[model samples]
Structures are given as C-alpha cells and as structure tokens.
Target: MASQNRPLSPHLQVYKPQLTSVMSIMHRATGIALAVGTLLLVFWLIAAATGERTFGDIQAFNASLIGKLLLFGWSFALFYHLCNGIRHLFWDAGKGFGLEAAYRNGRLVVVASIALTVLSWVWGYASMGAL
Candidate 1:
C-alpha cells in the first residue's frame, strides 16, 4: 500500500522556536551584519591613513545622528557575534552541547552582548564629553 501511517524524521516544523533558537539565528545574522559593517571600518582606517580632510569627512558622517544609530547597531552586532562566537568555541571543544547548557549559554551570550555594547557606548560618549 502507498498509504502513509507516520511522518518521516527531521521534519522542518517538528520543533517550535525558542529563545535559544532565536538567539542562535540572531547570532548568525549579526555575524553577517558585522562583516558588512566592516566596509565602513576599512574606509575609516584608510581615510585616517590618507589626510585630515578625508578623515574629518569620515568622522563627520560617523558623528551624524543616522550614522551614530548605524554604528550603534553595528556595535551591538559585533558584541553579539563575539559573545556567541565564544559560546561556539565551547561547543567546538565538546562543551555546552546539552539542551540545558545550550539554553543557558545562549542567554549568557545575549546578556553579555548587551552589557558589552552598553559599556562601549557609555565610554564612547564619555570621551566625547556627552556623559
């Protein structure tokens, strides 16, 4: 008979999404974000190496509200990717593979990323005499 009595293994919708899953996906997404954001970093470095006018222009753009917002997002993404990367390294070393461990580590990464981002921005603003 060609009738199916049961579904096959590894069905895509079998498992519902969770915070840990969402964080994992976001981690990867932020990785791409940071990679793309690096174009500006490269430009900044090159401009610095070139001349004051070029560097001043770069700084001006980066100091604008929209530019600050973009860089803020970039900073968050960078920290998120970094924290998640460290978590992955633990996995690579055969740690935090259990479900409970995975969940905890995922939370740790997200929290640590947010904390780091806030700290960085705080320091940046302080240096700018804004705080």
Candidate 2:
C-alpha cells in the first residue's frame, strides 16, 4: 500500500518544460554530438597523411550534399556547446541565477550559436570561392 504521509516525486508528464530545462538537456546532447563529430576530423587527418588518393576520396565525400549537411550540423553543435559553456562559467562565478536572467541568457546563447555558425560557414565558403 502507498504511504499517505509521504510526499510524491514530481513526474515529467506533469512538468511544464522551461527554457532552463530545455537548454540543460540540449547542452548534454550537443556535448555528445561534438564527441562523435571529432571522429570525422580524425578521419580527414588520417586520409591527408596516407596519400593523395585517400585524401581525395575523403574530400569528394565531404563535398557531397549529405556531407555538407553533416558538417553544418556539427558546426552548429560546436557553437551551441561553446556558448552554453560560457553561460556555465557565469554561473560558476555566482551570477545570472535569477529566473529572468537565466531565461534571457538562454535566449542569448541560442542566438549567438546560430549567428556564429552562419558566420563560420559564410567565411569558409567565401574563402573557398563558393560564395
């Protein structure tokens, strides 16, 4: 039989998602994505060291539509993680703990991440003469 005097734990179904909670979850997810994306970096480096044929093959694949999409996703994850990490540093310094402050900072992180990602891709393409 359930105890009538004990307090019940809050269930996720009954909780309304807030920006702080959503950002916390996203921070964890982006961290994992960054780790997986590092493998692609390692592969590119190994291909370059092996020989021209191997490097060329990797380049060709990376230039494809799907590969571009993956690259964009990786870049976005990188920027998001970077921005959120900065927010964490502010928290470590004992700041921005207010509810409104947290929400505002969360929004800033999202905007900064998107802006940084777009700027990075634009610069990359421009340097490659694609822009």
Candidate 3:
C-alpha cells in the first residue's frame, strides 16, 4: 500500500481578489452593517419616546466625533447595500450576465453608492447649518 500527495483547492492566498468577488463580499458585509445600524435606530426611537432627557443624551452622543463617524459609516453602508441590491435585481432579471456588463455595472454600483453617500451627508450638514 502507498500514500500519494494530492493537489489542494485554490484559496484566498492562491487567487488574486477580483472586482466581482470583492463586491459580493462587500454586499454581505453592508447588509450586516445595516442590520446593526437598525438597532441604533430603534434605540434612538425608544429614547425619544422615553423622555426629553434621554433623547437629549442620545442627541449629544450622536453629535460627538466618534458617533458622527459611526453614523457616516452606517450611511455609506446603507447606500452601498442599496446600490448593490439594485445590481442584484438586474442580475435576477437575467441582465448584465456578460463579463463586460458585469464589470461595468459593478463599477457603476461603487461609484453611485459613494456619490449618493457623499451627497446625502452634504445635504444633511447643510440643512443643519453645520457646513
């Protein structure tokens, strides 16, 4: 009897990351981030219902630098998830199946998400007179 070495499957280290794969991974990640961000939304709502003091405390925290950063990240994740989800809808409709179209739409999703996120933040700050 004899044992033989066998070839193993290619993995992260063996293969370079591609745009499609990276976008797919990011879609799942942003989905999870949105779910977590929803919890913060619920907390804020509850604080509002509880009392002015509690709501004010929440507002104060949200006005802080760290809180602002988290909100910014959550907003970006929301936009990214939304744009990627729309891309998935097109895929489900049997569109953008070609490699070139897939690549083009993938870039479109990234650009649109970033643009929307920036625009929303700018609008928010402007409305609040913080800009």
Candidate 4:
C-alpha cells in the first residue's frame, strides 16, 4: 500500500481538561483510595480482636505522623467519593445534564467534600479531647 499521511486521533494531549472530566477522574481515584482505606479498617479490627499487644501496636502506628497523614488522605477520599456519588445519583435522575449544570455540580461536589472532611476531623478531634 502507498503511504498516505493521515491526521492522528485525538488523545489526552489534544483535549483540555474540564471540571466535570477532572471530577469524574477523581471520583474513580477516591473510590480506589476508599477501598484501600477499608483494608486498614479491617486490619485494625482484627488486631483489636486478636489481643492487646497487636491492638496497641496498630494504635501506636495509627498515632504516628505518617499514619495521621494517611488517615487524613483517606478521610478526604471518603468524603470526596461520597459527594461525587451523590452527584452521580443526580445524573442518574436526569438532572445536571447541561454543561453549566455539570460544572456547577462539580464545583459543589469539590467544596462539599472538603468541608465535610474538615468538619469530620474537627468533630473527631474534639470528641477525643485532642482539640
């Protein structure tokens, strides 16, 4: 066959990122993060059931700086996934279909997720007398 130069198909570099698209990608990522976070929860639970020594070790690690950072990330992921899930429900209900509405809802999901995560951490710390 004779070589004929044809235009390449559009790829990631060809498209500009939009708010809705970014949020959609984040939704999947946060979902994965939540799954991993659940594993941590199960580990903690098993440790608690096993004995004091195992539980104490888990607690100690959980109280460490790195652990706290991971917990913070996991909490944020949880809230983000939750808010995005609700947004998805709205889409399922045939709402937020317009571009403007999609952008608006995307912004709302981002703001609500951050607010909820912060509030939850604050409440948790206060309840623990660590605030």
TM-scores of the models, in the order given: 0.86, 0.89, 0.90, 0.89
**Model 2 over residues 45-124: C-alpha lDDT tens digits?**
99999999999999998899999999999999999999999999999999997999999999999999999999999999
- Judging by lDDT against the true structure, name the best candidate: 2
Model 1: weakest 10-residue lDDT segment is: 1-10
What is the C-alpha RMSD, rounded to one decimal, of candidate 2? 3.6
The clash count for each model shown is 0, 0, 0, 0
Best-performing candidate as measured by TM-score:
3
Model 3, TM vs. native: 0.90
* Model 3, residue pairs in steric clash: none
What TM-score would you give candidate 4 relative to the actual structure?
0.89
Q: Clashing pairs in model 4?
A: none
Candidate 4 regions off by >4 Å?
A: 1-10
Off by over 4 Å in 3: 1-10
**Better model by lDDT: candidate 1 vs candidate 3:** 3
Candidate 3 clashes: the total is: 0
30-77, model 4: which lDDT tens digit per residue? 999889899889999999999999999999988999999999999999
User: Model 1 over residues 58-87: C-alpha lDDT tens digits?
Assistant: 999999999999999999999988888899
TM-score of 2: 0.89
